[model samples]
Target: MNLLHANDRRGEYPASYYTASATPLAPFPMLKGQVETDICVVGAGYTGLSAALHLAEAGFRVVVLEAHRVGFGASGRNGGQVGSGQRLEQDQLEGMVGRTRARALWDMGEEAKTLVKDLIARHAMPVTFRPGIAHACYSQGEADHAKVMAEKLARDYDYDLVDPLPEGLIGSTAFKGGDIDRGAGHIHPLNYAIGLALAAVAAGVVIHERSEVHSISEGARQVVRTGEGQVVCDHVVLAGNGYLGRLEGRVAARVMPINNFIIATEPLGDLARTVLAEPVAACDTKFVVNYWRLSDDNRLLFGGGESYGYRFPDIVKTVRKPMLEIYPQLRDVKIDHAWGGTLAITMNRLPCFLHPRPGLWSVSGYSGHGVAMATLAGKLMAQAIGGQTGGFDLMASLPQARFPGGAALRWPLLVAAMTWYSLRDRLGL
Candidate 1:
C-alpha cells in the first residue's frame, strides 16, 4: 500500500492535535499540464520546503510538489523535539569516521539547530521555541553513561549545555537519573513546518499541493511527473522522506520507512506540574524511545510505540501502554488526539544523503532526528546546487549502509530485528 494513502485521506491532514490548533494555509493549486523550473523538489515536508525557500532566496526558480497538504506527513506529527548532535553521538561518530571529521559532524549538528532557531526568528514565524530537553535514564548504568557523554561533549567539543541529574528527571520517579541539555529544545512541529512553507512561498517558490510525484525521467534536463502534470527542471531533489516510495532506488536501498505513533492528552491544567515540573521535553533510554513534552495548552504530547508495516495500528492503545508506563498518574486523563506518521531510518541510524546521479539529489533516513537535520539538509542542498559544496559534501560522505534483502524482504527482516530489540527493552537486557 502507498503509505501516503494507506491510512489517510487524499489531500487532508490527519485529525491531529496540531491540525486542530494551528491555522492552515489556503491550498495551493495542483500541478496541471506542464511547468518548468530551476529545481523540482518532491515532498513539501521540512526538507523540501527548506530547500525550496533557500534556493528561491538565491534567485533560483523552484517548484515544490506535495502529495498532500503542507506538513501532512511526519513533519507535522512528530514529538517536536529539536535535538542536538547527529543521530549517533560524538563518540560513536569519532569511532566511525576519524576525530577530525566527527568534530566537523558535531559542528554541523550545532549549525542545524542554529538554522532552525534563526529561520523562525528571521521569518517571524508563529511557532514558539521552548528550551531544554531532558534525557531520562531508566537504570543507574544508563544514567552514568549519560553523565559520561555529557562530560565528553563538554571536554572534547568545548560545548557545555548538559547538566547531570543524578536524582532523576523532575516530576517522575520512573527514571533513575538523567541529564538536561539547555541547547536542545522543542517547538510546535506542525506550526514550524507551516511557517517554513509560508516563508518559501514568500521567497517566490511555487508549491503545488496534491501534486504527488510518480516518476522522474533523468537526462540533460530532469522531468518529474505527477498524475495530473509534470515539471521539467534543471535539478531534481528527492525530499519525500518516508513517503517518497520508490522514486529513487539508491535512497530506497539505504532508507527504510517505519511507522511511529503519538498521543496528546486533554489540557492538564494544574496537574500539568505533576507531569513535567518545567517546560522541558523529555525522552527515555528505550529501544523504541518514548518522547514527550507539554503543549502550550498544558496537554502532554507523548510519542511511543512502533509498527513495521505500512498500516498503522490502533494509535491510542499502542501509545498509551508506554505513556502510562512513564506517567501512570495520567491514567485517568483524557486522550485528545492520537496519530501515526511514517519516518525513514537507515541501518546505521545515520541520515542518508546521496548524489545518486548528476543534477539529482536525495536526502532522507534521518533516523528520527530530522527536525533539525532535515532542515539543514535542505539548506546544504541549496548551497551545493548554488556551487558551494563543503557542508553538503561532508554530510554526503557519511556512511549509509543499504538494508539487507533488498526491497522485497527488507520489511520482514526489519520486523524481526526490531522485535528482538524491543523484547530486550522489555526484559531490561
Candidate 2:
C-alpha cells in the first residue's frame, strides 16, 4: 500500500494538535505540465524544504514536489523534540566511526541544532524554540550511564549544556534519574515546517503540492514524473523519507519505514504545572520511547507506541496506554487529538546519505532523530550541489548497511526484532 494514502486522506493534514494551532498556508497548485529546473526535490518535508530554500538562495532554480501537503508526513506529526547529537550517542558513534570522525559528526550535530534555531530567527517563523530536553532513565544504572555520558561530552567535546537530574524529570517519580540537555529543545514541528516552506518560496523555490513523483528517468538531466506532469532537472533529491516507498530501490533497502503515534490531551489548565513543572520536553529510556511536553495552551502532547505495519493502529488506544504509564495522573484526561506518521530508520539508526547515482541524491533513515539532522541534511545537499561537498561528503561517508532481507522482508524482520525488544522492556530486562 502507498503509505502516503494508506492512513490519511489525500491533500489533507492529520487532525493533529499542531495542525489546529499552526498558521495555515494556502495550498500550492499541482504540477500540470512539464517543468524544468536546476533541481527537483521530491518530498517537501524538513529535508526537501531546507535544501530547496538553501539552493534557491544560492541562485539555483528549484522545484519541490510533494505527494500531499507540505509537512504532511512525520515532519509535522513528530513529538517535536529537536534532540542533540546523532541518533546514536557520541560514544557509540566513536565506536562505529573513529574518534576524529566521531568528533566531526558531533560538530555537525551541534551545527544542526544551530541551523534549526537560525532558520527560525532568519525567517521569523511563527514558532517558539523552547530550550531543554530531559533524558529520563528508568533504572539507576541507566541514570548513571546518562551522567557519565554527560561528563564525557563536557570533557571530550567541551560541550557543557547537559546537567544531571537526580530527582528525575517532569516531576515524575517513575524515573530514577536523568540528564537535561539545555542546548537541545522543542518546537511546534508543523509550524517550523511551514516556516521552511515559506522561506523556500521567498527564495524563489517553486513548490507543487499533491504532485506525487511516480518515477524518475535518470541521465545527464533527470526527469521526475508525477501524476499530472513531470520535472526535468539537472539534480534530483530523494527526501520523501518513509513515504518514498520503492521510488529508489537502493534507499528503500537501507531505510525501513515505521509508524509512531502521538496524542494530545485537553488543556490541563492549572494541572499542567503538575504534569511538567517546567515547559521542557522529556523522553524516557524505553525500547519504545515515551516522549511528552506541554503544548502552548498547556495540553499534554504525548507520543509513544510503535506499529510495524503500513496501516496505523488505533492511535489513541495505542498511545494512551504509554501516556498513562508516564503520567498516571492523566488517567482521566480527555484526549483531544491522536495521529500517526511514518518515519524511516536505518540498521544503525544513523541517517543514510547516499549519492546512489550521478545527479541523484538520497537522504533518509534518520531513525527517530530527524528534526534537526534532516534540516541540516537539506543544507548539506544544497552545498554539495553548489560545489562545496565537504559537509555532505562527511555525512555520506558514514557507513549505512542495507536491511538483511532488503525491502521486502525488512518489515517482518523489524517487527520480530522490535517485538523482542519491547517484550524485554515490559519485563524490565
Candidate 3:
C-alpha cells in the first residue's frame, strides 16, 4: 500500500485545525506532458517550496512536484513551534561533530529563524509569527539539566537567548522548571506554508499538485517521471522527507518515516490563561517530546505520540495522554481536531543531507525540528546547485549512518527502542 494513501486523504489536507483556519487556495493543475527546468524539486513542503522560491528569485527555472496539495503534510499540521538550535542541542552537537562545526551550525540555526521571519515579511504573508518558546521539564533533575544546557549555550556560543525558569515562577510546577528561548517562537504553520507557495509561484516557480515523482533516471541530465508527465532538468532536489517512498536508497536507508499526532482543544477563553499564562510555545524534555502552544483563537494545540508503522494511532487518546499530565485542568475540554503526519528521523536526530552522485540531491530526516531548518535547507540546496556550496556542504558533511539491518528490520528495532524510551518517560527515569 502507498504510505501517502495510507495516512491522509489523497490530494487533500488532513482534517486539522490548521486546515480550518488557513485561507484555502485553488488547487494547481496536475503535471502532464513534457517539461524542462533548471531544477526539479520533489515535495512541496517548506523544504522543497523554499528551494523553489529561492531558486526562482535567483533566476533559475524551477518546477516543484507534490503528491498532494502544497503543505498537505507535516508542514501544515505541526505544533507550529519554530525552535532554536539543531534537534540535538549545541553542546551535544559539539560532542558529535566538534566545537567549530557545531558553532557554525549554531549560527546557521540562528539564520534559519531569521530566514523564516524574513520570508514572512517579504511575502507579506497573513500568518502571525510570534516569539518566545518555553521549554518545559517534568522533574527537578530534568530542570537542572535544562539549566545547565542553557548556561552552556550562553557561555560557549556567546548566545543569551535561553533563560532558565525561576524556582517558584509561572511554569515551575506544571512544567517543573525549564528555560525560555526568546529567539525562537511559533507560527500558523498551514498559512505560512500557503504563503510560501504563493511567494514561490510569484517568483516564477511552477508547482504541480497531485504530481508524484514515480521514478528518476539520472545521467548527464535527470528525468523525473510523473504519472502523466516528465520533467527533464539539470538537477534534482529530493525534499520529500518521510512521505517520499523508496525513491533513493541512501535517503531511504538513512531516514526512517514515523508518524506523530496532535490534537487541538476548543477555544479555552479565559481558561486559556489557566492552561498557559503567556503566548509562548512550550515543549517538554521527553524522548518523545510533548509540545503545546496556544493557537490564534486561544485553543491549545498539543502535539505528542509517535508510531513507527504506516497507520496512525488513536490521535486524540495518544496526544491527550501527555497533554493531560501537563494540564489536568483540561479534563472537560473538547478536542476540536486530531491529526497525524509522518516525518523522517535519523538515528542521531540530525538531518540527513545526501548528494550520492553529481547533480542529484536528497535532504530529508529533519527529525522533529523542521519549521525553520527545513526552510533554510531549501535555500541552501538552491545555493549548492547555484555553485556556492559552502552552507549546503556544511549540512551535507554531517554524518548520517544507515539504519541497522537496513529498511527491512529497522522498523522492529526502532519500535523496541522507542518503546523503551517512552517507558522511561513514563517512569520519570
What is the lDDT of every predicted structure here?
0.92, 0.93, 0.89
Off by over 4 Å in 1: 166-169
Candidate 3 or 2, higher TM-score: 2
Candidate 2 regions off by >4 Å? 166-169
The lDDT-based order of candidates, best leading, equals 2, 1, 3
Question: For residue 46, what is the lDDT in candidate 2?
Answer: 99
Q: Estimate each model's TM-score.
A: 0.99, 0.99, 0.98
Candidate 1 residues 120-237, lDDT tens each?
9999999988999999999999999999999999999988999986343467777889899999999998899999999999999999999999999988899999999999999998
Candidate 1 accuracy as lDDT: 0.92
In candidate 3 the C-alpha lDDT for residue 409 amounts to 94
Cα deviation at 191, candidate 1, in Å, is 0.6
lDDT of 3 by residue, 31-72 (tens): 999998889999999999999999999999999999999998
- Poorest 10 consecutive residues by lDDT, candidate 2: 165-174
Relative to the true structure, candidate 3 has a C-alpha RMSD (angstroms) of 1.3
